[model samples]
Target: MVSIGTAEIISTHDAYHSSNWPALKPSEKKEMEKRRRIGSKPPTCEKKCYGCEPCEAIQVPTISSRPHLSHYSNYKPEGWRCHCAP
Candidate 1:
């Protein structure tokens, strides 16, 4: 036995499906596709750390040569570290 709430939900769902929605224009569709493609790809870093440290005490390299830790979006020479780095 279907409940009143279930029946209302089913009717609403059917109405929504039956409703006419405006189709995207060719330009809008192309823009959306372009955005999706751009958004899906990873960002490239402009500058990379060679061998610098924020502080002399912190002898460890700010950016590791390791492939995993190599990519940095906001790498500041002054900070000597990536803003996103943990």
Candidate 2:
């Protein structure tokens, strides 16, 4: 069975504007990247259809220094990058 809870999903769109999102500390970045390299790739995003609720909400209440999103789907799109953990 495919697992969906390991990694936090993020969009390339949001990633590009690093300023909007808080920066990860050097150690945090290193660890996240390292885990990503060793684990599976992040999930792609899927947009909700007209009149449909979002597949999943993408933000959650968090107090961690590192920024995070609530949900992301595997809807393939060009020029987007995703990250997943094992």
Candidate 3:
């Protein structure tokens, strides 16, 4: 069986000006703005794995400090486990 895993930036920290907000797409920027207006703190990032049976799992990394999104852009899921079923 073949399993495919994908990683995506779900939301960024509230430290907008200090992060890579300027480099984000227009749509992403809009979403962030909306979240901020609603006083919601978005996760740093998200990851998921998909198998033949459509199994789903979510993993969130821990951020020791408020780093730039640029750092997250290069994040590596070294020890992540996929819960996809065969």
Highest TM-score: which candidate? 2
Clashes of each: 0, 7, 0
Q: Model-by-model lDDT, in order?
A: 0.46, 0.47, 0.50
Lowest summed lDDT window (length 10), candidate 1: 52-61
Tens-place lDDT digits, model 3, residues 1-86: 23347644433344445565358898988996787674224332334442245444435455545565547577543323345545
User: What's model 2's lDDT at 40?
Assistant: 40
Q: Model 3 scores what on Cα lDDT?
A: 0.50
Candidate 1's error at 3, in angstroms? 22
Runs in model 2 with CA error above 4 Å? 1-19, 38-86
Per-residue lDDT value at 58 in model 2:
38
Cα-based lDDT at residue 82, candidate 1:
28
